[model samples]
Target: MNRIIAFLLLMTFCSCDFIEKKKVYSNDILDEELKTFNWNDVDEYPTFESCNSNLDNANKKKCFENTLRQILNDKLAKYEIIVSEEINDTVQLKITIDSQGTFVINNIVSNEVTQTEIPQLDSLLRKSLDSLPKIYPAIKRSQEVKTQFVFPVIIKIE
Candidate 1:
């Protein structure tokens, strides 16, 4: 009986060693996920306090954009920027909202004519963001994320 039990134990140990180890292809899975993920899209757009959070994604985005544009328009209107030459161009304002909900001007793209005519354009744009309302950072996969916007500001000065 002891000999039979010893033989069974040895067989069990040997058989266990022969079993294949399950390999985890985590890198491959990660690569596939990255390829399928949309890098430009966010789960939620950043919102201001006035924007209704319960609204649908499209409405929420529109509200946030309109609110921001309105605010910027109102602020810019206060400044009587005098340009030496009649200018009609658009300025592309690259604004970035960080994960901390802080607003910053990443870059200001303006025509040389516009820049020369209104040297204070950059400063004015920067100042407009200073009075922005409390913002909620964009959410992606339930995590706060930084977002960038290329806002076009039409400059029509006569």
Candidate 2:
């Protein structure tokens, strides 16, 4: 009985050693496969140094930032809800902006929690977009540049 038990243990250990490991990953798989299928955003950002390179004053940069912030806040203020509470949420809101500073929201990438979709969240996003003073100030070359901007929107329920 002892000899038979020892032989069975030895066979179990030896059988697994002959098995091969297979690789699941291949280059043929697209990068998007790793990300969620429902979401859409630019894979990267572009630099047009020629347009912004001419900005020589720190005041101008600050002005650009402040102006953009106020514009966004004013738009969001129109919502009567208690948005006084600040929070950060990332959803892809696609923005189209020309170098001249004209901007508009083209589309919004939303959460898929509801079957019919929530319109309140969408309305808030639209209002916030209309408030942007400018997409950006004229760059060094003064040529109109088209760029996609992603907005981080937060929604709170009370």
Top of the candidates by lDDT: 1
lDDT tens readout by residue for model 1, 1-158 = 99999999999989986796978799989998889988798999999999988998788888988998898889999999887889999999898999999998899999999999999999998898788989999899899999998988898999
Candidate 1: where is the Cα deviation over 4 Å?
Answer: 1-21
TM-score for each candidate, following the candidate numbering? 0.82, 0.43
- Candidate 2 residue lDDT tens string, 1-158: 99999999998888787785766666536564655443332222222223253554564444544555556667767766543434344456676666566667788776554212344766666766564433443333334456656665544333
Scored by CA lDDT, what does every candidate get?
0.90, 0.54
Q: In model 2, where is the ten-residue run with the lowest total lDDT?
A: 42-51
Give the least accurate 10-residue stretch of model 1, judged by summed lDDT: 15-24
> Which residue pairs in candidate 1 have backbone atoms (N, alpha carbon, C) closer than 3 angstroms, thus clashing?
none
